[model samples]
Structures are given as C-alpha cells and as structure tokens.
Target: MSCPFAQSPRSTPNRIPKRSSSERDSIYEVIDAAPLCHVGFTQQEQPFVIPTLHARSGDTLLFHGSTQSRLLQAIASGRPICCVFTLLDGIVAARSAMHHSMNYRSVVAFGTGRLLEDEALRQQAFRLTTEKLLPGRWETCRQPNEAEAKATAIAALMIEEATLKQRSGGPNDIESDLSGPFWAGVLPIQTVIGKPIPADDLPPGVEIPSRIASLTTSG
Candidate 1:
C-alpha cells in the first residue's frame, strides 16, 4: 500500500508548484534513497535544524542519537517537526547565470516525533537503520549490548503530511540565450562507494565480507 500522507498548506510548495508532487511512491522513493535528512524544529522560540542519519519504516521515519542529545530530546517532546530529505543529481549549467539550477529529488515532511519506547520496536528500528546504511551489515556485525542500547535514543515521525519536489535533465535557458557563448549542460553528480580500508588495530587475516565488497562493485 502507498503512503497516506494528505496534503496540507504547510506541505504545499508555492514556488515552482509544477515540480512538487503528492504522489506516495514519489515521496517514498526519495525518502528511502536518501542517506540522511535534516530535521527542523523550534524549541523555546529558537529554531534548530540538525542533520542526521535516517531510515524509512513503512510510512514512518526513524532516527536515532545519543540519549542526551538536545535535538533528539526536542523531537521526542511532540514539537512540530519539518524533516527534509534531498538527493542532488547534477548541477545544471546554463548559458545565462539566472537559468542555472540543480537536478534533485527532495521531500519535505511534517510530523511530530515520538520516542520508541517498546523494546521490540526499538530493536527493529536499529536493525532497519543499520541495513539501510549498508545492506547485510546488521547480520554480520555484533549486536548492540545492553549498555550501548540504553545509551542511544530512537524516535519515530509518523509523516502526517508531505510533499516531493524534483527537477531533472538540463538547464532551462531562454530562447535567445540558448546559443550564447556560454556552455549549457548538466554536470552529473553521484555518491560513490570507495575502496574499503581496514582499521589500523584490526586483527589480521579477516577478509572483507561480500556485502561490503559488493558496494564498490555496484558503485
């Protein structure tokens, strides 16, 4: 089933409305593809935007931090939150400076965070997060000990309303400037997984797991 996030004034895009979408698949795709998100909220009349790792679990988003983190504490207080996920695809160079733009997929979601108190759900979030960052990693690595688990805080945001905005392809230059002296094209951008480096103090003879090795191959 698709996400049920309804459109609201806060989730609507006034500028470049054509680029915005309410489609659940589109919104979910961007969220799942993004490795990190910026969560914005206001605490005590002061605005704060913090970037952190994130993972999507069904229609809800998961994030975690140190138990004492101010951002996590603010989020778990049920304050209004604006979480944004963005993926930059390329830089659009146009013949005219004003026409330059970037190709990207982004989502702006509105919700209020809630702490994941249940042990099972909290463990599930941790697994999903680890697998999201690196597939098959959770199974290969040692599970978090009780102390480690207790020191971390996990929260969920049940996306109440959200919108997806995206732009693709090359720059949109004016007709007169199409053939101008300046070049116009897209400088493609991508996130590449580089070769893995072993830890300096790691025991010798431990080979890289297939899951880690496959990243570079796929990248």
Candidate 2:
C-alpha cells in the first residue's frame, strides 16, 4: 500500500520536489537502514533535539532509555515529536563548487509519544530495539532482570505523517563545467564493521559470537 501520510506544507519539500517521496516502502527503507535517529521536542518553551536508537514495529516507532532521562520523560508526556533518520551514501564531486552535493537518504516523521505501561509490551520493545541494532543479539545476551526492566522506559510513537527525501548518482553540474579541468565523480561512502575486540575482562576461551563476526564479512 502507498503511504498513509498525506502531503502537507510541513511534510512536503519546497525545493527540488522531485527528490522527495511519501511512499510507505521508501520511508520504511530509510528508517530501517539508519542506525539511529534524532528526536526533536519542545519543553518549557525551549526546543531540544536528542539522538537516540530506535526501532520500527509495524507503523509505530519505538524509543527506549533510562526512565529517569529528561528526554524520555518529555517524550512520554504526550508532547509533539519530530523524528529524523538519515543515511549518507556518498559525496558528489562536481566540476563547479556550487554544484557539489552529498548523496543521501533521509526521513522526517511527525508523531506523539505514548509511554508503554504494560510490562509485556515494554519487554517486546526491548527485544525489537536490540535486534534492530544487531540481528540475533537479543538471544545472545543475558535478558534484563526485573530491576533493569523497571529502570528502563519504552516510548511508542504512532507515525502520523512522514516524508522521505533522497539523492543519488553523480553530481548535477552545468553544461559548461562538464568539460572543465576538474575531476567530477562520486566519492562513495559506506559504514563498515571492523574487527570486534573482546572485553579486557573477558575470560579465556571465550569467542566472538557468529552473528557478531558475520557483520564484518557482510558489511
């Protein structure tokens, strides 16, 4: 199905509208690929934007943090929230300086948060957030205890409206600059998983999990 978010002045891009989309799959793709997102909210007439990990459970986005955290408290109060996810793909090198740009995929979502009071639902959010960071990680690590669970808070945001904006391929340069002396091409960027290092206190004979090892090869 197409995106449920209708085009509004706030959600729509005023410039280069061709690069913007409101498609459901496109929006989800960007959100799922991003490792983290910035959540913006206003409290006491002051605005704040905090970066935090997030996960998608169907159309609802999940955020978790310490229950005592100011950001989490603000979010759980049912305040308006704006969440953004971004992935930088490459640096576009154009013949002219003004034509230079970065290739990226980004999403802007509008929602209001609701605290997950039910223990079962909060536990599910924990699992989803963990798996979102590293597949199979939730099963590999020790589960949270009652005290740990109580200390953590999970906030659910039902996406009310959203938009996806993306740019790809080479730079857009003027015709005259195409034959310029400068080299123009994309400097590809990627997120690579490096060798995993064991903890200093890790006991002997302990080995890295297969799922963790696979990230280096897969990336």
Candidate 3:
C-alpha cells in the first residue's frame, strides 16, 4: 500500500542523495508544516507541472482532483511523476556573494500514479485532506453532494524513488571569496501570518472563532 519511495533501498531507484536520519527528520517537519505540493510529470515526452493539495499518510502522499483534470488523466495513464514538497525557512546572507544560500527543506518523490476507487477509502482520504488544511473544517463545511463526489477524482501515489535534501548553514562562499567585501547572504524569509478576513456573507452575529484568530499569528 505504501509508495515505492517509502520502500527499502532494494525496492526502488535512488535518484537523490541518500537521506540521513537528520535529513529524514527535517523532511517530516517540512511536509507537516505545508499542505501543498508541486507535481511534475511528462505527457507525451513533454514536461508538465501542477500544484495540488496533498496529505501525507505515514510516508505516502495522497492527491485528489477532478477526474477529467489533465494532470489526473496523465497520472492514471501510468506516466511517471515527480512530486516536490518544499518549505523555505529563510534566506541566508553572506559577506561574500559566492557564499550566499537560502535555508530550505524539501522532499522529492517519484512514482507512477493511479486512480483510487474504494468508496470507504476515498472518504477517509477526504477526511485526512480536510484535517490537514484546517483542524475541523470538514465538519463545518457542507458535505459534498453525490453529484459533486461523482465529479471528483481521487488518486494515491506510491513514493517509489525519493530523497530529502536540506541546506541550512551560514554561507558556503569559497575561502578565497570570504575576504571579498561584496555583501552576499541569504535574505532570511518566513511566511507571515496576517489578520483573518471574515467572510463577506457571514451572519452579522457569528463571532470569529479563536482558532481562526490564532492562525493569523501562527507561523
């Protein structure tokens, strides 16, 4: 049931660097903090990429979209896909230009995608996806109608070939360039939380929940 990427080394190709325990730890952190991923694949030898919402169950990443979606159709046809989920923690600044680099954690997964058909499993996948974006959104939003559900497409990708790489240090400038006066360094960046905008159609008396308010200040 697991993607090929999550399998032992003997089971899949190693396209990226072998991930150490430290690297693995960082991957989990980055993935958990984000709910979207960039999926790359080739259709007819032409490269294609798409951004999709995803949920990580243990080591497998699940994606669901419209059945007629070009991306989903490509995957269902057995095309190989490369999924990259990344988090940018900060940009590093270095005294020398050559040494400048950003701090980042990312996971690259490759595999063939497939259509998910089990009714119960699809419901579970829907729930997992809902919980990832919002703690209790599924319960709050109106459930999907039969027509809506029928129009959707659910997919599960096996992590076959994968690796996690993280670069997070001062600067990697060459020793010779270290003496250079040119200013160079990662410009540390972060995702900032802003005040929540209440829904325009929301009832006048419905108060903003503390949870929604908290997200505004949360990293």
Full-model lDDT for every candidate: 0.90, 0.90, 0.72
Report the number of the highest-TM-score candidate. Answer: 2
| lDDT tens digits, residue span 91-191, model 2 | 99999989899999999998888899998899999999999999889989998999999889999998888999999999889998888799999999999
Q: Work out the TM-score per prediction.
A: 0.96, 0.96, 0.81
Candidate no. 2 TM-score = 0.96
Looking at candidate 3, the ten consecutive residues that score lowest on lDDT are: 15-24
Per-structure clash totals for the candidates: 0, 0, 16
Q: After superposition, how far is residue 146 of candidate 2 from its true place, in Å?
A: 0.4
Q: Which tens-of-lDDT digit does each residue in 1-219 have in candidate 3?
A: 222235446333354344332234555666777668898888778898899888877656778788889887877777778888888878888776455667887777777777888988788788888878876667767777788878988887766656666677667667777677677655676776687777889988987666556667642
Candidate 1's TM-score: 0.96
